[model samples]
Target: MTERTPFRARVHAPGAELDVQAYDFESPELIGGDDRARLDAALEAWGRQVGMLITAKTRAVVDVATAPSRIQSFGAFIASAEGPVLWATASSAGGRILYRIPLEEARYWAARMIGAAGDAAGDGAPLTSVERALARQVLTEQLAELQHATGGMFAEPVLEAFGTEPPSSVDRDAQAVVAVIGTLRRNDRRQLAAAIDAELVLQRLGAVAPHQDAAQVRTRIGGHLALAPVEIALRFDPTRVGPDTVLDLAAGDLIPLAHLADRPLVVTLDGEPVLHAAVGGNGERLACVVVSNGDLV
Candidate 1:
């Protein structure tokens, strides 16, 4: 037996934990070219409505504009989004959406809500109790009304809560998309970002049943064609005979056809073979049941 050296244990460092919030976004994008284009068109209309609503409610003069949409996870959206925001959770039948407006703009809106002009917590401080309550009331009602009036993506949005940060229950990994609504007032530009439910947006974009459209077209054309009356004729393979053979044929003369007796005959529509059928008798009338396209023997 050989002598062994003293054994020693070595410790290994644990693998670095994955920080999802800080994770780089190398993943495939959610929306595609056509969806983006459709969203853009919808946003254009939405902007007009939003502009009118803002002036009506806030009494603030701001130019509302639409920004192109973005696709990302909730975590990524929160991570990359800049500035402190006032967040509200809007729930409806369709689903819930997280809306965030920069504190600066929120202050502006809050100020106007309580009959003030750009004077509600403009120093990056929290909104006053009265200002916050009024903000919540206006936000929930205005957003809900916008959905109903537009008859578009959202339904009746009931605000669940308003806070300095998003609710803790919101899944960081949940798929989400962002839409920015820009406003300009008194030379101030601000963007309000909404981390909307990805599925809701996708549902709106693809609400049209494009896959069934072709079937509908086929059914429509078939229905119209079925209404038209056409002369149909049963045909058999023609016999290839010389002109002299035809001339020799006389009364009571038997002319053998080239078609095989066992084989099915062709049913023609407008001189085109649309179906194949076997020779049969139905209630003493010559008839046939349609057969397979391949060798209807």
Candidate 2:
């Protein structure tokens, strides 16, 4: 037996210990490329909507990033339908603050900024809270306008979620960690849609040329168009007739008009009377021409 080297009892010293602490792992489901693409498109739409709501000088930007392990700081304007409720934030990286701006606040701030600018040029007084509120109402009304213009391309649930919150101020940074956690949990599919829409609208508005008048630009772009004849026919409100009468009418029965003989049949564009023309017989064809304005009688 080769003199077996006396097995040196090599007592290995224990390596330094690692500081093990509780690690909060964020959800790593990973927003997919398709999801991200959808988000981008929705955000663009939102920015455009906001831009149309506010004056040209005002601007908004939206970004998404990984939440930091430690608290960071951020700042942003908290707006509502009423006006700039406040500017608040929590800490964030790269000097940016995390924020949740209510739709009301956005509407308010946009209106206020525009109104102030108008006043500066002697066009009108600075927008009061009431005026801001009115602007918000207009914004709500224009939701339909956006949907129609976009041909329902954007989802409605998303826009609704973003605009659901009323105007109010908040200190997102005061409870920075909590805010981040809460945002992750509370921002569901609907909220995400809303956020994207808001961001897109704002971005588009901000990109408009500075020389162009915001109000005039909005007027030109936002003007309601005459729906195609087929579209108009499809949307015709039959509510004018009693439900029972409507149900009882046979295929051959002619629906009587509320108008009288010699009265010009009124043609409306988007439910608004745009033209008045008298009914005439051109051989076997019925014709019409512009006439005096009056209620259907």
Candidate 3:
């Protein structure tokens, strides 16, 4: 009976938790890694989905020497239904990096998913299950779009591990988690390696034009010429015209074009003479001999 002290119970209100916010996730192990290409592709895809363009140089994983570790922040652009929203975040993935997104970025993405489901439904009403399925589909599609937008700059080997298709019932939270995990998969490592090698080859290949037969260039040039405009103009020399005497000036008098016989006509373009030819009769109409070598002007 020595322990007779009363024990008091502690109760917390619904909202009594401290408001300590967790910083954005980062991985120090990712720094100076051999799989930069896959990570880069993944980042690129993520950025694109958020309508953002980010650079690895501006971000940091962690300051290994500092207490509590710090990550650098960078700028980002987020797209919303209203327009682009701008914000910044400090990331701890590689170097000092920042992430900025629109205030409604998440909502905008959700809406896009809903819209995609609607499109897939045609005229039928979409059920909750159908909507969830569509949302997952849209998420995958949008992820691809992001990959393209970044030009494969952000690589993630993890995506290849899960294959292309995501789960059907993924919600927003699950989607985010899966996306990050997919970015970290081992298969992505090989993909990134291939991409790096390909990029290097392309860089070298772009340095010089491949040697082609002369006929090819000539053919190409001729095809280009065929698509260009051709202009033909006929010019007359004043000396070929007879003077309009007083007899020829009489009322209702018809003057014949007799001086247009056997004289060479000129063809010019932009005031530069290009050809000389004789004016001749073609049936009841007049024609010209297009001299190939003479100057027209």
> Candidate 1 lDDT, tens digit per residue, 222-277?
77666554555678987898899899999999888999997778977668776787
Pairs that collide, model 1: none
Write down the TM-score of every candidate.
0.56, 0.27, 0.27
Candidate 2 residue-wise lDDT at 35: 45
Q: Rank by lDDT, descending?
A: 1, 2, 3
Model 3 spans > 4 angstroms off: 1-47, 50-215, 238-262, 269-271, 283-285, 295-297
Clashes of each: 0, 30, 25
Off by over 4 Å in 1: 1-27, 119-121, 207-297
Evaluation by lDDT, superior candidate among 1 and 3: 1
> Can you write out model 3's per-residue Cα lDDT over 1-297, one digit (the tens) per residue?
565333222333435764444445431122223344444444444533432211121121111110111122111001111233222221111211112222232222344444432112123223245443433443344334433554554332222111122222222121011121111212211011011122222222232256789999997987765544344456765443347564468788765654466666776554566677776677986666776543433
Task: Please rank every candidate by TM-score, starting with the best.
Answer: 1, 3, 2
User: Per-residue lDDT tens digits of candidate 2, residues 7-32?
Assistant: 12222233644344443433222233
Give the range of the ten consecutive residues with the poorest summed lDDT in model 1.
Answer: 5-14
